[model samples]
Target: MTEPPFELEPIGEVRTPFETSDEAPRQGLEGEEPTHGEIVLAPAFEPGLEGIEDGETVDVLWIADEADRSVLRVRDGERGVFSTRSPHRPNPICVTTCRVRAVDGRRLAVSGVDMLDGSPVVDLKAPLE
Candidate 1:
């Protein structure tokens, strides 16, 4: 197999209450209340958070480090990995849309998180128009 063309370095990490996959919701909005979390960006990436206002929605791209990367089918074996939101794929890069509750220096307070604590955040972007 050919090697990947590039490498990904985490610019930050997601801080959530979930310590294990079982503790996390399947989706960000799955629970009765939107899960709250924080994106703690590295000092070098702090400047990139400029102009990101409170109440704005953004896409957070992160690595599912705890995912089972060898699986290509859903747990029920009824659908292919690509056809489902299953994190158990060749590359466990995941994205979730979250609302910014607050922004303080290198930390962003957000809601609608499904990720576990300390998940490496690859990038953050405004939702595509």
Candidate 2:
């Protein structure tokens, strides 16, 4: 079978200490779970991040941007593709959430990151009511 084609235009890049996926936590934006990473949004999104505030965490949807998409099944092999935090085998796409640490004009300093360095950010939104 022939794989279909797809295209992706990176909106911006993220910076974090997670140099390798092996070091990355099992969960994205573990929040209070104990992680020391941040997300730096592009300057163009400053106006959009106006609503975010300190302690007001928002979900940062990002692309793994560095993971391989050939492996599936959980480590214990006890769950289906639609169950649990098994994004390790996503369809070449990855998403994560981060807490809005601080917003300085167009620069967003956030924590609770689980993505690799220089990852691609797709979308971000404050938690819905």
Q: Give the best candidate by TM-score.
A: 1
Off by over 4 Å in 1: 1-5
lDDT of 2: 0.68
CA error at residue 12 for candidate 2, angstroms: 1.9
> How many residue pairs of model 1 clash at the backbone?
0
**What RMSD does each model have against the real structure?**
2.3, 4.0
In order of listing, the candidates' clash counts read 0, 0
Candidate 1 lowest-lDDT run of ten: 1-10
Candidate 1 positional error at 95, Å? 0.5
- Candidate 1 residue-wise lDDT at 7: 83
Highest lDDT against the true fold, candidate = 1
Clashing pairs in 1: none
Q: Write the per-residue lDDT of candidate 1 for residues 8-114, one digit (tens) a residue.
A: 99999999999988899987855689999999999999999999999999999999997888898885888899988777788999989998999999999999999
